[model samples]
Target chain A: MAELTYRDAVIRGIAQEMTRDPDVVFIGEDIGKAGGVFKATVGLYDQFGPVRVRDTPISEQAILGAAMGAAMTGLKPIAEIMFSDFIAVCFDYIANEFPKSRYMSNGQVKCPLVVRTGNGGGARFGAQHSQSVENWCMMIPGLKVVAPSSPRDVIGLMAAAVRDPDPVIFFEHKSLYATKGEVPDGEIVDTLGSAKIVRPGKDATILALALMVPRALAAAEKLKSEHGIDCEVIDVRSLVPLDTKTILGSLARTHRLFTVEENPRLCGWGAELVSIAADEAFYDLDGPPVRITTPHIPLPAADLLEDIALPSVERIAERVQRSLQS
Target chain B: MAKLEDRAPAPKGSLNDDIGEEKRLALYRTQVVIREAEQRAYDLFLQNLVKGTSHLSLGQEAVAAGFAGAMRPGDLSFCTYRGHAHTLARGVPIVQVLGELMGRDIGLMRGKGGSMHLTSVEHGVMGSYAIIGAHLPIACGAAWRAQYKGAKDVSVCFFGDGTTNIGAFHEALNFAAVWKLPVVFVCENNLYMEYTPISDVTAVKHPAADRAASYGLPRIVIDGNDADVVYRAAIEAYDKARAGGGPSLIECMTYRYSGHSRADPAKYRPEGELERWKERDPIKLYRERLRAFGVGEDAILRIDAEVKREVDEATEQCKAAAPPALDILTTDVYADGGFAWRN
Candidate 1:
């Protein structure tokens, strides 16, 4: 086992796929020689050269449009949007173009591509740059949305996303890039739409994704020791093809549900999960599902303000502990 | 009347002679088929057989015919919702095009895509994007793919005058120019942007041609009503792109006979505008040109008669075809052939 940062795992995952298939190409702004703005794609350009690892102008529409075009023809391209917030700039390609290509063409077109964007907050990049907008992509019907919390899951899920015969929105949290975890050597291929039970417990079920997964895990430990509540924490990795089986099974055992989210509270991904559980597993629930999320407001830039705005371990632990007691 | 040389982009060139009689006759036939098919499509729309809405390329057949004729078999063609002509020009069956317009099971996309998004990968008709300026970058990507694979095929993207103002148009042009991708952007400057004249809202007199300099591309404009002129221009652009000359932007001055869509009566059109453009009808000009070129009258008559028969047959087949099956509602939503989001 080797320890890898979440950022390095991104490079390894892309390199692994590009090495396996010559058809895989990468395109984005400053992603070639500059190694991306965040240094996530540090070594791809030197390895693949300019033809495969292309640097594009600051044109989001062109980046995704070209990617869609390439994918439609023959190439399996991995496009980067720099920041997930900028996905709004080229939302037409995400919302209308690639997603609708297959259905509109009656399966004559297949968009086997991945759009990797730096997502989430706590870095104090201000309102426009620091929003956790995974919910924005998840709401789109034809897109597969995945956000990995740990370094190991990052490589595994990214490999799965690239190999899938569809367009996937891979959201890498800006905060989690420096986080480290042990990844097994050699190939690490994982499945999409599968959730991992990070902390197994029977008292109550706590669900989270991306950065919130670790926070949820930490909160679960605190709740178990301090509040005498052994909570089951599941990392909901893929939002589109959600792992409802594991979540619902956990809910059945614990008879209580809680969702930790980094996105604004309105129409968050957790709301959909809560609705699904309410409808399908209403009898299995002991009380109304509780959601611990950032309030519906623009993310602040101040260190204290941003840190408090985002759901932290203390906030999640307190909320779950209080909700379960009530 | 004035000679073809007087109006062509290359006023003094021997390139016209190289087009050959065989290709000229084929281009004429393609324009005739597009013209006949468009008229039948209008007729069906009038009878309420073509449901929803359609954007017709009534007077823009030459642009589709010329470009599609110039493209190789594996070469890709991307255009806007005004795409029936482009689809047929790429050799997609008239019956399937009509079937799609009428929302039939035998349509190009089996009625799922309806009239706007006509696509036939087998025929190299990539897609008909309804959104303006959206497919320009997509065509660049296709060209980039060919360049990556070291292939010689070029991607030809077509759009109307209104598309020039969209951000994607500028982004795609600059992107293609910077990357030196093998693609040709054809702007069918029909002088109108929906109901308003394109000149009214556009900064320059010529929307696409004038903006070519901004992207470091040559400004090549031609008379779109002349199929021979458009054909030669397309060949030149495609040849340059195939020879690793990078992207080229050619603005073809054509006109649309119908409104922006079936919903508009085109009341915004100035008086005598439609009549003035009709004088230079592509089919009429091509027929006269074919006669002038000494193509026998019998051959021209045969193509016209055959095209008329084909349109009638396609119309009948479309009328008899049924609506798509209900089970198709959930199919093709994902690559897995199922719409299930959770399991």
Candidate 2:
């Protein structure tokens, strides 16, 4: 096993796949020798040269659309869109073009493209860069959306997304780049749409993703120690093929649920979880589901304001307490 | 008396040994077939035999026929919605084309992609997009694949003058140049972008050639109505791109005989413009040139009969063909049986 940061794990996954498969190439703005803005692609330029890991002009539509073409033509291209905020610029390529090709062509083309972008706030990047738009992507039919919280899961999920036969929107949280974890040596593969039970407890189920997963874990720790409540934390690794089985299984045991996210509370990913639980496992619930998420406001830049606007461990713990009591 | 774009496209150049009498005749036949087929489709639409919208390539058949003939097999192309001529030039079966237009089960794309989005991956057509300039980057990506995989094949993208203004056109061109991808950007500058004249919208003297200096590419403004001219330009560009010389943009100054869509009568055209262009119609001009080159009237008449018969049989077959099965709507969302992620 090796201890690496979340960003390093992403590079490892890409480099390993590139080395193994000659057809695999990575393209983005500043991804070549500059090693990417976050340096997630460091050392890959010297390793693969310009053809495989190419730098591109500041064109999101071209990058994503080019990747779609490359994927259809037998190249497994991992295209980085810099930040998830810029996905709006190339929205049609993802929301319209990427998904429609396979369905519209009647199974003639396969779009095996992976789009990687940094998401979530708490870094003071302001409203444009800090937004988490997983809900926007998860709605697409032919595309898969995945957000991994840990180094181990990131490596596994990145590799898996590359190997996937369809389009994958891989969301990497900017705040969790330096977080270290032990990624097992040799091949470590995880299923794309399955959720993992990071913490197993019978008292309550906390469903979270990416930046919110750590906060949920911390809240679970507080609930266990201070409030004498056992909370199961479920990291939603893949949002599209959501691991409803795991979430529902946990709900069956705990009877109480807390959905946490950094996206806007209204029409958020948490709402999807609530709807799923309510529709499938309504009788199993003890009380109404509690949602801990950022309010529908543009993320402010100041540290104090950003902290207040975002989801936190304390708010989640309080929500967990409230959910249990109610 | 003349009107807009009154100047004529250059006459056919001296023939090279590569283009034999047989190939010349074949090219002429393809252009005629395209013109006839497009007219038939329009006629079908009038009769309510064909559903949905169509963007016909009535006067611009030479450009489609010329380049499609020039490209080697397995080389892909991405085109705009006015791609019926391009599809016919790529040699997609007439039955399939008409069946698709008629929304039959046996159509190209299995009737999912109608006149606007006809697809034939086997014949190396990626698809024609309904959105302008959308397929440029896609063609560049395919060219990148050809170069990356050590293949000799190239990719061609056909769009209008209006597409040059879209962000995708600039982005695709820059990417193709930066990567030295083997792609050819063919602009069918048919005088107008829908109803708006090129003079009102475009600022440059030559839309396609003007961007070449920035991208460090070899570009040309050509006589698109001249089949021989387009063929020569397309052949050279294809060879250069395949030889790792990077992309080239060819702007063809032609005119669309019909309106932008089926309903458009093109009343926006200036006085005598339509009449002047009709005097130099591609099919008529090509027929005279073929006779000058010693192809007999009997042979020409036989070719016309063959094309007319092909269109007739295709129309009849399409009229009798079945609609898609009801269960097909439930299928093809995913390759496997997994459901779409509904919110």
**For this target, which candidate reaches the highest DockQ against the unseen true structure?**
1
Off by over 4 Å in 2: B1-18, B337-343
lDDT of 2 by residue, A18-40 (tens): 98899999999999989999989
- Weakest ten-residue segment in model 1 chain B by summed lDDT: B8-17
DockQ of each: 0.88, 0.57
Candidate 1 per-residue lDDT, tens place, B1-343, comes to 1123377442232224777678988999999999899889889988999989899999999999999999898999998999998999999999999999998999999998988899999999999999889999999999999999999999999999999999999999999999999999999999888988999999998899899999999878888888878887888898999999999999898889988888988988889989999999998888777777677899999999999999999899888998999999888889998788888
lDDT of each: 0.92, 0.87
Indicate the TM-score of model 1: 0.98
Query: Candidate 2: deviation at residue A81, Å?
Result: 1.0
**Deviating ranges (above 4 Å) for candidate 1:** B1-16
lDDT of 2 at B61: 88
The residue-by-residue lDDT of candidate 2 on B178-275, one tens digit each, is: 88899999999988888888768777877777877878876578778878777878898998898899988888878899999987889999999988
Deviation (Å) of B331 in candidate 1: 0.5
